[model samples]
Target: MGFKKHLSSLKSYEAGKPIELVIRDYGIRQKDIIKLASNENPLGTSKKVIKAIKKEAKNSYRYPDDSMFELKKSLAKKYKVDSKNIIIGQGSDQIIELLVQATCGSEDKILTSSLTFAMYEIYASHNQAKVLKTKDGVHNADQFIEIYQKSKPNLVFLCIPNNPLGDCLDRSEVYRILDSISSDTIVALDCAYGEFAAYKDKNKEIKPKEIIKKYKNCIYLGTFSKLYGLGGLRIGYGIADSNFIEMLSKLRAPFNITNLSLKAAIIALEDSTFLKNSLKNNFKEMKVYEDFAKSKNIDFIESYTNFITFMLPKSIDSSSLCEYLLKQGVIIRDLKSYGINAIRITIGLREQNKTTIKLIDKYLKR
Candidate 1:
């Protein structure tokens, strides 16, 4: 009646509180609550995606395309990569799990920053691979290269515009790490927030396809969750070398992605107007939050993504501050989970952003 020791040792991912949970805990009405905790799109899914989902709703009785042919083909055309190089998943989360299963073993190790995305450590531990925590929070390329030269891991998970901190390693730093790592090591780049990152940067844009083509071991992971606003559909994909794609494809469960999700993702990609609007709204809100933080004399990390992380005064505990915010019907993330004395607030709709800032100002004054 016992599970593996590693299973017992694994820490579960702590997701944000649901709106219902916040309402129940604070005895507040659901209508008053605004959740900015999970880094999800506040605008929700695009109209085209919603239409596609509804149109395909009647086909629920039929099995989905296991190969995700059309989705893969669309992605291939969009990224100018070969269809053979693409592998779709329930989400980029599942793709991360699949990559661990496909490439790692009990004796293998997975390298990643200490406070990066929690999934990297979770999946690595689930696969019984040694989770090698890196020293830097930013995943500096020189630090990674120094460690890889010594430990030589089987897989590496790098999150650009790193979660919680919202700090991105420069492209030059990334290139350095790529050049230093062993050719045998598989590098997985989690670009879940890549679209938002690109939208935030005024001077630089990262073309993931270029890196994918240049390095055989490199794999780029993208999700419809952020910019396209398809978190509910749970659709994502990986772009890599054909051999890696084929290997990962074999391990992918049949009909792992729903027909509705695939249809929605196809339309989401084509909705250029929605994409542009989402970026515009996010950028505008980001500046508003930055100015508000400055006026309040609060220190915050500059972000190249939709979410902003800021520190509470030393006199206030983040957990208590989050609790207070919850009672006020604003649910922002408590960075205690990420081992920081900070909180992350996602860029929401203008009204929501304004309300959240007012609430924070009120809380700080009291």
Candidate 2:
């Protein structure tokens, strides 16, 4: 038997290893390992969400609501959007795949910045769409406008506070891309880390909701994986024009989300206290990272998200440095996969952050 040529050319996504797997591989105790690879919320899921999950656990025999009506309603209320404009997915990654499946064809091109989220490229390839990589590690709106004018891509993926780099484009830049693109082209804004982005000057406000409302061709993708600490649950959603939402609904599998996950998400959404605390802690830890990098005279990009990406000194090999950190029970992301000589480390608990810095200092000194 033979597969399609496109399928053969597709590269599988390499996710971060589980703590248990890392422990087994290194023959180290689980207690000693600290994983900061995936940019997860170090505070973990809210207590209310935990309780909701536990309460719903006994009802595992029942299938989830295919419409996800309750969850959709909660989101609609939170974002001030209509329920008809929302569609749920297993995660933001799944939403990206569905967008590609619905809109893109084998010869269609998807435009994205270089070194953006890897999943966008993977999903585009899976759907047989040609991907056009931008020149810079950062996604500049002007570059996107130029590319769109020349190539006229069917779809575009923009990661605000982009992965691997942790930098976000200003609202004016995003608006320029949105305004310049042809109406026939679709724009997908991946705001998975939106909640972590602080008020930077006057232009960096969270604007995806407003953008979705303004542009019929625009879709806003969000995930509970980062802010709500629900990565294990694999729950995320998209907000778009009602017509696009309807199309996505038809393409989505029934019961795509689990009952427990729905319940947890509902509770998580209502946990204002937890959300506040998580954001506060994230800012505090991020400042610590910033101060540490400054003190060490290290070059790092200022992050608007939970993760920080810093260049490795010319004397040190990034992969080897990562390995050294791993041996010391500190796990962080190596950006070699993204064609960069940098590493991304997630902001964790205060004690964990201190320990990670200490370990990295020890390794760098030697």
TM, every model: 0.96, 0.97
Model 1: residue 126 alpha-carbon error in angstroms: 1.2
Query: For residues 218-317, could you state the per-residue lDDT of candidate 1 as single tens digits?
Result: 8999999888898888999999988878888888888899999999999999999999998999888899999988988888888888799887778768
Clashes, model 2: 0
Cα RMSD, each candidate: 1.5, 1.3
Report how far residue 38 has shifted in candidate 1, in Å. Answer: 0.9
Best by lDDT: 2
Q: What digit string (tens of lDDT, one per residue) describes model 2 on residues 1-366?
A: 587766876788877757987788898899889999998999998988998898899999999988889999999999998889899999898899888898887889999998898888888888778899788887788888889899999999989878879888887888888999877899998989877764433465555568777898999889999989999999999999999888778888888999998998898999999988988888888888888888888889878888898887788678888899888788999888777788899999999999999988887889
Candidate number of the best TM-score: 2
| Global fold similarity of model 2 (TM-score) | 0.97
Q: List the lowest-lDDT window of 10 residues for candidate 1.
A: 199-208
Q: Tell me how far the alpha carbon of residue 108 in candidate 1 is from the true structure, in angstroms, after superposition.
A: 1.9
Question: Where in model 2 is the C-alpha error above 4 Å?
Answer: 198-202
